[model samples]
Target: MPDTPAAPRFRSGAGRICLDFMRTLRLRGMDGATEELDTPEALAAWVAQLGPYPGGTKIPAPAEGVLGEARAVREAVYALLTAARSPAGPAGCPPKERGLLNRAAAAAPPVPVLDAAGSVTWTAGDPVGAVLADIARDALSLATSPALDRVRACSGPHCAAWFLDTSRPGNRRWCSMETCGNQAKKHAWRTRHATATAI
Candidate 1:
Protein backbone atom coordinates (compact mmCIF):
# COMPACT_ATOMS: atom_id res chain seq x y z
CA MET A 1 0.00 0.00 0.00
CA PRO A 2 1.17 3.53 -0.71
CA ASP A 3 2.02 5.52 2.37
CA THR A 4 -0.46 8.21 3.39
CA PRO A 5 0.64 11.80 3.51
CA ALA A 6 1.46 13.05 7.00
CA ALA A 7 -0.68 15.74 8.51
CA PRO A 8 0.73 19.26 8.52
CA ARG A 9 2.66 20.19 11.64
CA PHE A 10 1.19 23.18 13.44
CA ARG A 11 3.29 25.35 15.74
CA SER A 12 1.97 25.02 19.29
CA GLY A 13 4.72 27.09 20.94
CA ALA A 14 2.71 30.29 20.53
CA GLY A 15 1.06 29.36 23.85
CA ARG A 16 -2.12 31.00 22.63
CA ILE A 17 -4.85 29.80 20.30
CA CYS A 18 -4.99 33.00 18.30
CA LEU A 19 -1.25 33.01 17.69
CA ASP A 20 -1.38 29.40 16.62
CA PHE A 21 -4.20 30.28 14.24
CA MET A 22 -1.90 32.83 12.63
CA ARG A 23 0.66 30.08 12.08
CA THR A 24 -1.58 28.31 9.59
CA LEU A 25 0.03 30.62 7.06
CA ARG A 26 3.12 28.48 6.61
CA LEU A 27 6.54 29.54 5.31
CA ARG A 28 6.01 33.28 5.53
CA GLY A 29 9.69 33.64 4.69
CA MET A 30 9.42 31.79 1.38
CA ASP A 31 8.10 33.07 -1.94
CA GLY A 32 5.36 30.45 -2.31
CA ALA A 33 3.46 29.87 0.92
CA THR A 34 1.72 26.73 2.05
CA GLU A 35 -1.73 27.20 3.52
CA GLU A 36 -2.60 24.51 6.02
CA LEU A 37 -6.32 25.17 6.01
CA ASP A 38 -6.64 25.07 2.24
CA THR A 39 -9.70 22.92 1.87
CA PRO A 40 -13.01 22.17 3.59
CA GLU A 41 -11.71 18.71 4.44
CA ALA A 42 -8.56 20.22 5.85
CA LEU A 43 -10.60 22.65 7.92
CA ALA A 44 -12.81 19.85 9.20
CA ALA A 45 -9.80 17.79 10.13
CA TRP A 46 -8.22 20.72 11.87
CA VAL A 47 -11.38 21.35 13.88
CA ALA A 48 -11.64 17.68 14.83
CA GLN A 49 -8.07 17.73 16.10
CA LEU A 50 -9.03 20.64 18.36
CA GLY A 51 -11.35 18.29 20.12
CA PRO A 52 -13.76 17.76 22.93
CA TYR A 53 -16.62 18.46 20.60
CA PRO A 54 -19.74 16.57 21.80
CA GLY A 55 -19.41 12.89 20.80
CA GLY A 56 -21.43 13.07 17.61
CA THR A 57 -21.33 16.72 16.77
CA LYS A 58 -21.22 17.09 13.01
CA ILE A 59 -19.22 20.03 11.71
CA PRO A 60 -20.83 21.23 8.53
CA ALA A 61 -18.38 21.33 5.64
CA PRO A 62 -17.26 24.86 4.88
CA ALA A 63 -19.03 26.50 1.99
CA GLU A 64 -17.26 28.20 -0.95
CA GLY A 65 -16.34 31.45 0.81
CA VAL A 66 -15.86 30.14 4.35
CA LEU A 67 -12.19 29.25 3.95
CA GLY A 68 -11.38 32.71 2.56
CA GLU A 69 -13.25 34.34 5.41
CA ALA A 70 -11.46 32.22 7.96
CA ARG A 71 -8.09 33.13 6.46
CA ALA A 72 -9.01 36.82 6.50
CA VAL A 73 -10.00 36.63 10.15
CA ARG A 74 -6.75 34.87 10.97
CA GLU A 75 -4.77 37.63 9.28
CA ALA A 76 -6.69 40.30 11.17
CA VAL A 77 -6.11 38.57 14.47
CA TYR A 78 -2.43 38.31 13.60
CA ALA A 79 -2.21 42.00 12.78
CA LEU A 80 -3.86 43.01 16.04
CA LEU A 81 -1.65 40.80 18.19
CA THR A 82 1.56 41.81 16.43
CA ALA A 83 0.58 45.46 16.80
CA ALA A 84 0.04 45.01 20.51
CA ARG A 85 3.62 43.79 20.80
CA SER A 86 5.02 46.66 18.77
CA PRO A 87 7.25 49.26 20.48
CA ALA A 88 4.59 51.80 19.73
CA GLY A 89 1.36 51.06 21.60
CA PRO A 90 -1.10 48.66 20.00
CA ALA A 91 -2.20 49.76 16.54
CA GLY A 92 -5.90 50.05 16.06
CA CYS A 93 -7.49 46.98 14.47
CA PRO A 94 -8.86 47.67 11.01
CA PRO A 95 -12.59 48.36 11.20
CA LYS A 96 -13.49 45.64 8.72
CA GLU A 97 -11.39 43.04 10.50
CA ARG A 98 -12.76 44.12 13.87
CA GLY A 99 -16.27 43.82 12.51
CA LEU A 100 -15.52 40.32 11.21
CA LEU A 101 -14.21 39.29 14.61
CA ASN A 102 -17.25 40.79 16.33
CA ARG A 103 -19.56 38.72 14.15
CA ALA A 104 -17.62 35.52 14.83
CA ALA A 105 -17.55 36.30 18.55
CA ALA A 106 -21.30 36.67 18.49
CA ALA A 107 -21.83 33.31 16.82
CA ALA A 108 -22.46 30.04 18.66
CA PRO A 109 -19.91 30.37 21.42
CA PRO A 110 -18.04 27.35 22.80
CA VAL A 111 -19.17 25.81 26.08
CA PRO A 112 -16.69 24.33 28.50
CA VAL A 113 -17.54 20.92 29.91
CA LEU A 114 -15.75 18.64 32.33
CA ASP A 115 -15.03 15.16 31.10
CA ALA A 116 -15.05 11.94 33.13
CA ALA A 117 -11.42 12.57 33.99
CA GLY A 118 -12.39 16.01 35.24
CA SER A 119 -10.48 17.81 32.53
CA VAL A 120 -12.18 20.83 31.01
CA THR A 121 -13.10 20.48 27.31
CA TRP A 122 -15.08 22.56 24.86
CA THR A 123 -18.12 21.82 22.71
CA ALA A 124 -20.14 23.90 20.28
CA GLY A 125 -23.04 23.70 17.82
CA ASP A 126 -21.05 25.03 14.85
CA PRO A 127 -17.42 23.99 15.02
CA VAL A 128 -16.12 26.66 12.65
CA GLY A 129 -17.93 29.48 14.39
CA ALA A 130 -16.91 28.13 17.77
CA VAL A 131 -13.23 28.01 16.86
CA LEU A 132 -13.36 31.49 15.36
CA ALA A 133 -15.09 32.78 18.49
CA ASP A 134 -12.42 31.21 20.66
CA ILE A 135 -9.71 32.86 18.58
CA ALA A 136 -11.45 36.24 18.73
CA ARG A 137 -11.86 36.04 22.49
CA ASP A 138 -8.26 35.03 22.98
CA ALA A 139 -7.01 37.84 20.74
CA LEU A 140 -9.08 40.39 22.65
CA SER A 141 -7.80 39.15 25.99
CA LEU A 142 -4.15 39.07 24.88
CA ALA A 143 -4.43 42.54 23.42
CA THR A 144 -5.90 44.09 26.59
CA SER A 145 -4.23 42.04 29.33
CA PRO A 146 -0.68 42.46 30.64
CA ALA A 147 0.13 39.18 28.90
CA LEU A 148 0.48 41.07 25.66
CA ASP A 149 3.97 41.97 26.79
CA ARG A 150 4.87 38.29 26.69
CA VAL A 151 4.30 37.94 22.96
CA ARG A 152 7.45 37.77 20.86
CA ALA A 153 8.23 37.19 17.20
CA CYS A 154 10.85 34.52 16.56
CA SER A 155 14.24 35.96 15.57
CA GLY A 156 15.15 33.06 13.27
CA PRO A 157 16.19 34.06 9.76
CA HIS A 158 13.24 34.05 7.42
CA CYS A 159 10.96 32.95 10.24
CA ALA A 160 7.86 35.01 10.95
CA ALA A 161 6.35 32.80 13.62
CA TRP A 162 5.25 34.39 16.92
CA PHE A 163 5.38 32.92 20.38
CA LEU A 164 4.69 33.79 23.99
CA ASP A 165 7.77 34.20 26.17
CA THR A 166 6.73 32.60 29.44
CA SER A 167 10.25 32.40 30.85
CA ARG A 168 11.07 34.26 34.04
CA PRO A 169 13.61 36.37 32.14
CA GLY A 170 11.35 36.92 29.12
CA ASN A 171 14.34 36.50 26.79
CA ARG A 172 13.07 33.83 24.40
CA ARG A 173 14.07 34.31 20.76
CA TRP A 174 12.97 31.28 18.76
CA CYS A 175 9.63 29.63 18.18
CA SER A 176 11.07 26.24 19.17
CA MET A 177 14.53 25.36 20.39
CA GLU A 178 14.24 21.97 18.74
CA THR A 179 13.79 23.56 15.33
CA CYS A 180 14.81 27.19 14.71
CA GLY A 181 16.95 27.37 17.84
CA ASN A 182 19.00 24.35 16.81
CA GLN A 183 19.41 25.74 13.32
CA ALA A 184 20.71 29.00 14.73
CA LYS A 185 23.14 27.22 17.05
CA LYS A 186 24.52 25.15 14.20
CA HIS A 187 25.00 28.23 12.05
CA ALA A 188 26.82 30.03 14.83
CA TRP A 189 29.11 27.04 15.39
CA ARG A 190 29.98 26.93 11.70
CA THR A 191 30.70 30.67 11.65
CA ARG A 192 32.99 30.48 14.70
CA HIS A 193 34.84 27.46 13.33
CA ALA A 194 35.34 29.19 9.95
CA THR A 195 36.72 32.30 11.69
CA ALA A 196 39.21 30.20 13.70
CA THR A 197 40.27 28.32 10.55
CA ALA A 198 40.98 31.63 8.79
CA ILE A 199 43.18 32.72 11.70
Candidate 2:
Protein backbone atom coordinates (compact mmCIF):
# COMPACT_ATOMS: atom_id res chain seq x y z
CA MET A 1 0.00 0.00 0.00
CA PRO A 2 1.16 3.57 -0.63
CA ASP A 3 2.38 5.48 2.41
CA THR A 4 -0.54 7.30 3.99
CA PRO A 5 0.18 10.96 3.30
CA ALA A 6 0.34 13.42 6.15
CA ALA A 7 -2.10 16.33 6.28
CA PRO A 8 -1.10 19.76 4.97
CA ARG A 9 0.06 22.41 7.47
CA PHE A 10 -0.92 26.04 7.28
CA ARG A 11 1.41 29.00 7.01
CA SER A 12 0.70 31.36 9.90
CA GLY A 13 -1.77 34.02 8.64
CA ALA A 14 -5.30 35.03 7.50
CA GLY A 15 -4.97 33.67 3.97
CA ARG A 16 -4.38 30.28 5.47
CA ILE A 17 -7.45 30.70 7.64
CA CYS A 18 -9.50 31.90 4.67
CA LEU A 19 -8.28 29.04 2.54
CA ASP A 20 -8.91 26.61 5.35
CA PHE A 21 -12.46 27.78 5.88
CA MET A 22 -13.14 27.63 2.15
CA ARG A 23 -11.92 24.03 2.04
CA THR A 24 -13.91 23.13 5.12
CA LEU A 25 -17.08 24.53 3.61
CA ARG A 26 -16.44 22.69 0.36
CA LEU A 27 -15.63 19.35 1.96
CA ARG A 28 -18.46 19.38 4.48
CA GLY A 29 -21.05 20.33 1.89
CA MET A 30 -19.99 18.80 -1.42
CA ASP A 31 -17.90 15.78 -0.44
CA GLY A 32 -20.71 14.07 1.52
CA ALA A 33 -18.72 13.88 4.73
CA THR A 34 -20.78 13.24 7.86
CA GLU A 35 -18.23 14.36 10.42
CA GLU A 36 -19.72 17.14 12.50
CA LEU A 37 -17.48 19.56 14.37
CA ASP A 38 -18.84 21.25 17.47
CA THR A 39 -15.68 22.91 18.68
CA PRO A 40 -12.57 24.78 17.58
CA GLU A 41 -10.57 21.56 17.68
CA ALA A 42 -12.83 20.21 15.01
CA LEU A 43 -11.94 23.20 12.83
CA ALA A 44 -8.26 22.73 13.60
CA ALA A 45 -8.42 19.03 12.82
CA TRP A 46 -10.13 19.73 9.51
CA VAL A 47 -7.39 22.17 8.59
CA ALA A 48 -4.70 19.69 9.58
CA GLN A 49 -5.96 17.31 6.90
CA LEU A 50 -5.15 19.83 4.16
CA GLY A 51 -1.59 18.48 3.90
CA PRO A 52 1.43 20.10 5.53
CA TYR A 53 2.19 23.73 5.03
CA PRO A 54 5.47 24.55 3.23
CA GLY A 55 7.16 23.38 6.44
CA GLY A 56 5.65 20.52 8.39
CA THR A 57 4.79 22.13 11.73
CA LYS A 58 1.69 22.98 13.70
CA ILE A 59 0.72 26.64 13.83
CA PRO A 60 1.20 27.90 17.33
CA ALA A 61 -2.15 27.73 19.05
CA PRO A 62 -3.84 31.07 19.65
CA ALA A 63 -4.15 32.51 23.12
CA GLU A 64 -7.65 32.16 24.50
CA GLY A 65 -8.50 35.76 23.65
CA VAL A 66 -6.97 35.45 20.21
CA LEU A 67 -9.17 32.49 19.42
CA GLY A 68 -12.29 34.56 20.00
CA GLU A 69 -10.98 37.35 17.79
CA ALA A 70 -10.03 34.97 15.03
CA ARG A 71 -13.47 33.43 15.22
CA ALA A 72 -15.05 36.86 14.92
CA VAL A 73 -13.08 37.62 11.78
CA ARG A 74 -13.94 34.28 10.29
CA GLU A 75 -17.61 34.93 10.90
CA ALA A 76 -17.32 38.37 9.33
CA VAL A 77 -15.77 36.85 6.21
CA TYR A 78 -18.67 34.47 5.89
CA ALA A 79 -21.18 37.25 6.37
CA LEU A 80 -19.59 39.30 3.64
CA LEU A 81 -19.66 36.33 1.32
CA THR A 82 -23.32 35.72 2.07
CA ALA A 83 -24.20 39.33 1.39
CA ALA A 84 -22.32 39.36 -1.89
CA ARG A 85 -24.13 36.31 -3.20
CA SER A 86 -27.55 37.90 -2.79
CA PRO A 87 -28.43 40.44 -5.52
CA ALA A 88 -29.74 42.82 -2.83
CA GLY A 89 -27.44 45.82 -3.17
CA PRO A 90 -23.74 45.14 -3.65
CA ALA A 91 -24.03 43.92 -7.21
CA GLY A 92 -26.34 46.71 -8.27
CA CYS A 93 -24.11 49.46 -6.87
CA PRO A 94 -20.45 48.62 -7.15
CA PRO A 95 -18.63 51.55 -5.53
CA LYS A 96 -20.57 51.82 -2.30
CA GLU A 97 -21.03 48.11 -1.85
CA ARG A 98 -17.37 47.43 -2.50
CA GLY A 99 -16.43 49.96 0.15
CA LEU A 100 -18.73 48.30 2.68
CA LEU A 101 -17.47 44.85 1.84
CA ASN A 102 -13.85 45.99 2.14
CA ARG A 103 -14.55 47.41 5.56
CA ALA A 104 -16.08 44.16 6.73
CA ALA A 105 -13.37 42.00 5.17
CA ALA A 106 -10.73 43.86 7.14
CA ALA A 107 -10.14 41.16 9.71
CA ALA A 108 -8.21 42.57 12.62
CA PRO A 109 -5.80 40.40 14.60
CA PRO A 110 -6.88 39.37 18.06
CA VAL A 111 -4.88 40.78 20.92
CA PRO A 112 -2.93 38.08 22.67
CA VAL A 113 -4.07 36.85 26.05
CA LEU A 114 -1.71 38.13 28.74
CA ASP A 115 -0.75 37.08 32.23
CA ALA A 116 -0.52 39.33 35.30
CA ALA A 117 3.06 40.09 34.32
CA GLY A 118 1.71 41.55 31.05
CA SER A 119 3.41 38.77 29.15
CA VAL A 120 1.57 37.62 26.05
CA THR A 121 0.42 34.03 26.36
CA TRP A 122 0.67 33.68 22.58
CA THR A 123 3.63 34.71 20.46
CA ALA A 124 5.10 34.15 17.00
CA GLY A 125 4.37 30.49 17.54
CA ASP A 126 0.70 31.39 17.38
CA PRO A 127 -0.18 31.49 13.67
CA VAL A 128 -3.25 33.69 14.21
CA GLY A 129 -1.05 36.78 14.05
CA ALA A 130 0.43 35.51 10.84
CA VAL A 131 -3.09 34.91 9.55
CA LEU A 132 -3.92 38.52 10.38
CA ALA A 133 -0.88 39.67 8.42
CA ASP A 134 -2.07 37.68 5.43
CA ILE A 135 -5.51 39.26 5.73
CA ALA A 136 -3.91 42.70 5.71
CA ARG A 137 -1.95 41.92 2.58
CA ASP A 138 -4.97 40.46 0.87
CA ALA A 139 -7.12 43.47 1.72
CA LEU A 140 -4.50 45.86 0.39
CA SER A 141 -4.14 43.84 -2.76
CA LEU A 142 -7.88 43.89 -3.34
CA ALA A 143 -8.07 47.63 -2.82
CA THR A 144 -5.04 49.05 -4.67
CA SER A 145 -4.18 46.34 -7.14
CA PRO A 146 -5.31 47.36 -10.63
CA ALA A 147 -5.21 43.75 -11.71
CA LEU A 148 -8.24 43.16 -9.51
CA ASP A 149 -11.14 44.44 -11.55
CA ARG A 150 -13.88 42.49 -9.84
CA VAL A 151 -14.03 40.77 -6.48
CA ARG A 152 -17.28 38.94 -5.89
CA ALA A 153 -18.89 36.05 -4.06
CA CYS A 154 -19.20 32.77 -5.91
CA SER A 155 -22.57 31.78 -7.43
CA GLY A 156 -22.93 28.35 -5.85
CA PRO A 157 -25.70 28.22 -3.20
CA HIS A 158 -23.80 25.78 -1.05
CA CYS A 159 -20.65 27.89 -1.42
CA ALA A 160 -20.49 31.37 0.06
CA ALA A 161 -16.90 31.96 -1.04
CA TRP A 162 -15.14 34.95 -2.53
CA PHE A 163 -12.56 35.21 -5.30
CA LEU A 164 -10.93 37.82 -7.46
CA ASP A 165 -12.40 37.66 -10.92
CA THR A 166 -9.20 37.39 -12.90
CA SER A 167 -10.81 35.60 -15.79
CA ARG A 168 -10.96 37.56 -19.06
CA PRO A 169 -14.74 37.25 -19.07
CA GLY A 170 -15.02 38.64 -15.51
CA ASN A 171 -18.05 36.40 -15.01
CA ARG A 172 -16.54 33.72 -12.86
CA ARG A 173 -19.24 31.84 -10.93
CA TRP A 174 -18.18 29.08 -8.56
CA CYS A 175 -15.26 29.17 -6.15
CA SER A 176 -13.96 26.01 -7.80
CA MET A 177 -15.40 24.16 -10.75
CA GLU A 178 -14.52 20.81 -9.25
CA THR A 179 -16.24 21.62 -6.02
CA CYS A 180 -19.36 23.73 -6.40
CA GLY A 181 -19.97 23.80 -10.15
CA ASN A 182 -19.55 20.07 -10.53
CA GLN A 183 -21.72 19.35 -7.51
CA ALA A 184 -24.50 21.59 -8.81
CA LYS A 185 -24.45 19.97 -12.23
CA LYS A 186 -24.55 16.49 -10.68
CA HIS A 187 -27.49 17.40 -8.47
CA ALA A 188 -29.42 18.98 -11.34
CA TRP A 189 -28.81 15.94 -13.50
CA ARG A 190 -29.94 13.61 -10.76
CA THR A 191 -33.12 15.62 -10.23
CA ARG A 192 -33.88 15.67 -13.93
CA HIS A 193 -33.36 11.93 -14.29
CA ALA A 194 -35.38 11.21 -11.17
CA THR A 195 -38.28 13.29 -12.49
CA ALA A 196 -38.13 11.70 -15.93
CA THR A 197 -38.22 8.21 -14.42
CA ALA A 198 -41.15 9.16 -12.19
CA ILE A 199 -43.03 10.41 -15.27
Candidate 3:
Protein backbone atom coordinates (compact mmCIF):
# COMPACT_ATOMS: atom_id res chain seq x y z
CA MET A 1 0.00 0.00 0.00
CA PRO A 2 1.14 3.56 -0.68
CA ASP A 3 2.32 5.40 2.40
CA THR A 4 -0.19 7.87 3.76
CA PRO A 5 0.70 11.43 2.97
CA ALA A 6 0.93 13.97 5.73
CA ALA A 7 -1.90 16.45 6.08
CA PRO A 8 -1.65 19.94 4.66
CA ARG A 9 -1.00 22.23 7.62
CA PHE A 10 -1.36 25.95 8.25
CA ARG A 11 1.18 28.23 6.61
CA SER A 12 3.42 30.35 8.83
CA GLY A 13 6.65 32.43 9.01
CA ALA A 14 4.75 35.45 7.63
CA GLY A 15 6.72 37.71 10.05
CA ARG A 16 3.63 38.83 11.90
CA ILE A 17 0.96 37.04 13.88
CA CYS A 18 -1.81 38.87 12.08
CA LEU A 19 -0.33 38.17 8.67
CA ASP A 20 -0.06 34.52 9.53
CA PHE A 21 -3.64 34.51 10.75
CA MET A 22 -4.77 36.24 7.57
CA ARG A 23 -3.56 33.25 5.61
CA THR A 24 -6.08 31.02 7.30
CA LEU A 25 -8.27 32.06 4.42
CA ARG A 26 -5.91 30.71 1.80
CA LEU A 27 -5.91 32.27 -1.66
CA ARG A 28 -7.85 35.26 -0.41
CA GLY A 29 -9.41 37.47 -3.10
CA MET A 30 -8.39 35.02 -5.78
CA ASP A 31 -9.60 31.98 -7.62
CA GLY A 32 -9.68 28.68 -5.71
CA ALA A 33 -9.82 30.49 -2.39
CA THR A 34 -9.97 28.08 0.49
CA GLU A 35 -11.15 28.68 4.02
CA GLU A 36 -8.93 26.73 6.37
CA LEU A 37 -10.61 28.02 9.51
CA ASP A 38 -14.12 26.92 8.68
CA THR A 39 -14.86 25.32 12.05
CA PRO A 40 -14.40 26.14 15.73
CA GLU A 41 -12.08 23.16 16.11
CA ALA A 42 -9.94 24.49 13.30
CA LEU A 43 -9.60 27.80 15.13
CA ALA A 44 -8.50 25.98 18.28
CA ALA A 45 -6.02 24.00 16.23
CA TRP A 46 -4.62 27.20 14.82
CA VAL A 47 -4.12 28.54 18.32
CA ALA A 48 -2.27 25.36 19.23
CA GLN A 49 0.03 25.67 16.23
CA LEU A 50 0.43 29.44 16.04
CA GLY A 51 -0.52 30.86 19.42
CA PRO A 52 1.92 31.10 22.35
CA TYR A 53 0.46 28.02 23.92
CA PRO A 54 2.67 25.14 24.96
CA GLY A 55 2.82 21.96 22.94
CA GLY A 56 0.34 19.23 23.88
CA THR A 57 -1.90 21.79 25.51
CA LYS A 58 -5.55 21.20 24.76
CA ILE A 59 -7.25 24.33 23.43
CA PRO A 60 -10.99 24.29 23.73
CA ALA A 61 -12.95 25.10 20.60
CA PRO A 62 -14.59 28.51 20.89
CA ALA A 63 -18.32 28.99 20.55
CA GLU A 64 -19.91 29.83 17.20
CA GLY A 65 -20.11 33.50 18.13
CA VAL A 66 -16.44 33.69 19.03
CA LEU A 67 -15.59 31.85 15.83
CA GLY A 68 -17.46 34.46 13.81
CA GLU A 69 -15.70 37.21 15.72
CA ALA A 70 -12.31 35.65 15.04
CA ARG A 71 -13.02 35.38 11.30
CA ALA A 72 -14.08 39.03 11.31
CA VAL A 73 -10.89 39.97 13.06
CA ARG A 74 -8.87 38.08 10.45
CA GLU A 75 -10.55 39.93 7.58
CA ALA A 76 -10.07 43.26 9.37
CA VAL A 77 -6.38 42.57 9.72
CA TYR A 78 -6.11 41.79 6.01
CA ALA A 79 -7.98 44.91 4.91
CA LEU A 80 -6.10 47.16 7.30
CA LEU A 81 -2.75 45.86 6.12
CA THR A 82 -3.66 46.11 2.43
CA ALA A 83 -4.54 49.75 2.92
CA ALA A 84 -1.45 50.44 4.99
CA ARG A 85 0.76 49.00 2.25
CA SER A 86 -0.80 51.37 -0.24
CA PRO A 87 0.50 54.87 -1.12
CA ALA A 88 -2.13 56.43 1.15
CA GLY A 89 -0.52 54.50 4.02
CA PRO A 90 -2.18 53.86 7.33
CA ALA A 91 -4.64 56.67 6.69
CA GLY A 92 -6.26 54.35 4.18
CA CYS A 93 -7.35 52.05 6.94
CA PRO A 94 -11.13 52.24 7.03
CA PRO A 95 -12.98 53.15 10.20
CA LYS A 96 -14.84 49.84 10.36
CA GLU A 97 -11.69 47.76 9.98
CA ARG A 98 -9.83 49.97 12.41
CA GLY A 99 -12.58 49.71 14.99
CA LEU A 100 -12.71 45.91 14.69
CA LEU A 101 -8.99 45.71 15.21
CA ASN A 102 -9.21 48.05 18.17
CA ARG A 103 -11.85 45.95 19.86
CA ALA A 104 -9.96 42.73 19.23
CA ALA A 105 -6.74 44.22 20.51
CA ALA A 106 -8.39 45.29 23.73
CA ALA A 107 -9.06 41.69 24.76
CA ALA A 108 -6.70 39.98 27.24
CA PRO A 109 -3.87 37.98 25.72
CA PRO A 110 -2.11 34.86 26.87
CA VAL A 111 -0.30 35.14 30.20
CA PRO A 112 3.24 33.88 30.38
CA VAL A 113 4.10 31.55 33.25
CA LEU A 114 7.65 30.72 34.28
CA ASP A 115 8.28 27.40 35.98
CA ALA A 116 11.18 26.31 38.17
CA ALA A 117 12.30 24.08 35.35
CA GLY A 118 13.32 27.12 33.35
CA SER A 119 10.44 26.66 30.97
CA VAL A 120 7.76 29.17 30.11
CA THR A 121 4.20 28.36 29.13
CA TRP A 122 1.24 30.48 28.13
CA THR A 123 -2.25 30.38 29.57
CA ALA A 124 -5.41 32.37 29.00
CA GLY A 125 -8.94 32.32 30.29
CA ASP A 126 -10.11 32.15 26.70
CA PRO A 127 -7.26 30.77 24.64
CA VAL A 128 -8.86 31.38 21.25
CA GLY A 129 -9.85 34.93 22.11
CA ALA A 130 -6.44 35.59 23.61
CA VAL A 131 -4.79 34.48 20.39
CA LEU A 132 -7.11 36.74 18.41
CA ALA A 133 -6.15 39.63 20.65
CA ASP A 134 -2.49 38.96 20.04
CA ILE A 135 -3.05 38.92 16.28
CA ALA A 136 -5.00 42.18 16.45
CA ARG A 137 -2.27 43.91 18.43
CA ASP A 138 0.34 42.72 15.98
CA ALA A 139 -1.69 43.97 13.02
CA LEU A 140 -2.01 47.41 14.58
CA SER A 141 1.73 47.64 15.15
CA LEU A 142 2.70 46.39 11.68
CA ALA A 143 0.25 48.64 9.84
CA THR A 144 1.63 51.87 11.29
CA SER A 145 5.34 51.14 11.42
CA PRO A 146 8.12 51.59 8.88
CA ALA A 147 8.34 47.83 8.71
CA LEU A 148 5.19 47.95 6.66
CA ASP A 149 7.47 48.46 3.70
CA ARG A 150 8.94 45.01 4.26
CA VAL A 151 5.64 43.21 4.05
CA ARG A 152 5.04 41.82 0.56
CA ALA A 153 2.43 39.84 -1.25
CA CYS A 154 3.76 36.51 -2.48
CA SER A 155 4.87 36.47 -6.11
CA GLY A 156 3.35 33.07 -6.71
CA PRO A 157 0.92 33.49 -9.58
CA HIS A 158 -1.96 31.80 -7.78
CA CYS A 159 -1.07 32.60 -4.20
CA ALA A 160 -2.79 35.48 -2.45
CA ALA A 161 -0.60 35.23 0.63
CA TRP A 162 1.68 37.90 2.07
CA PHE A 163 4.99 37.61 3.86
CA LEU A 164 7.55 39.85 5.52
CA ASP A 165 10.73 40.42 3.55
CA THR A 166 13.30 39.69 6.26
CA SER A 167 16.19 39.22 3.82
CA ARG A 168 18.96 41.76 4.13
CA PRO A 169 18.34 42.91 0.56
CA GLY A 170 14.55 42.90 1.02
CA ASN A 171 14.08 40.87 -2.20
CA ARG A 172 12.49 37.85 -0.64
CA ARG A 173 9.43 36.39 -2.39
CA TRP A 174 6.93 33.57 -1.93
CA CYS A 175 5.31 32.61 1.37
CA SER A 176 7.60 29.61 1.85
CA MET A 177 10.55 28.08 0.05
CA GLU A 178 9.00 24.68 0.53
CA THR A 179 5.75 25.54 -1.19
CA CYS A 180 5.19 28.46 -3.57
CA GLY A 181 8.90 29.04 -4.03
CA ASN A 182 9.45 25.49 -5.09
CA GLN A 183 6.54 25.57 -7.46
CA ALA A 184 7.83 28.73 -9.10
CA LYS A 185 11.31 27.25 -9.52
CA LYS A 186 9.88 24.12 -11.06
CA HIS A 187 7.79 26.12 -13.45
CA ALA A 188 10.74 28.19 -14.57
CA TRP A 189 12.82 25.08 -15.13
CA ARG A 190 10.07 23.47 -17.18
CA THR A 191 9.65 26.56 -19.30
CA ARG A 192 13.37 26.75 -20.03
CA HIS A 193 13.56 23.05 -20.80
CA ALA A 194 10.59 23.24 -23.13
CA THR A 195 12.10 26.17 -25.00
CA ALA A 196 15.46 24.43 -25.34
CA THR A 197 13.86 21.25 -26.65
CA ALA A 198 11.78 23.18 -29.15
CA ILE A 199 14.85 24.89 -30.54
- Model 1 residue 62 lDDT? 81
Q: Residue 177 lDDT in model 2?
A: 75
Candidate 2 residue-wise lDDT, 100-143, digit = tens:
33553454433356789876543333344444444433443434
lDDT per model vs. reference: 0.77, 0.48, 0.91
Q: After superposing candidate 3 on the true structure, give the runs of residues whose Cα lies further than 4 Å from its correct spot.
A: 1-8
Decoy 3 TM-score against native: 0.94
lDDT of 1: 0.77
CA shift at 91, candidate 2, in angstroms?
17
Please say which candidate is ahead in lDDT: 1 or 2: 1
Report the C-alpha lDDT of model 1 over 44-75, residue by residue, as the tens digit: 66666553475445677787587887888788
lDDT of each residue in 1-199, candidate 3, tens digit only: 9999656478889989898999999888888899999999999889988899987789998898988999999999988998898887877888998999999999999999999999988999999989999999999999998899999999999899888899999999888889899999999999999999999
Better of 2 and 3 by lDDT: 3
- True-vs-predicted CA distance for residue 161, candidate 3, Å: 0.6
Per-residue lDDT value at 139 in model 2: 42
Model 3 lDDT-worst window of ten? 5-14
TM-score for each candidate, following the candidate numbering: 0.84, 0.52, 0.94
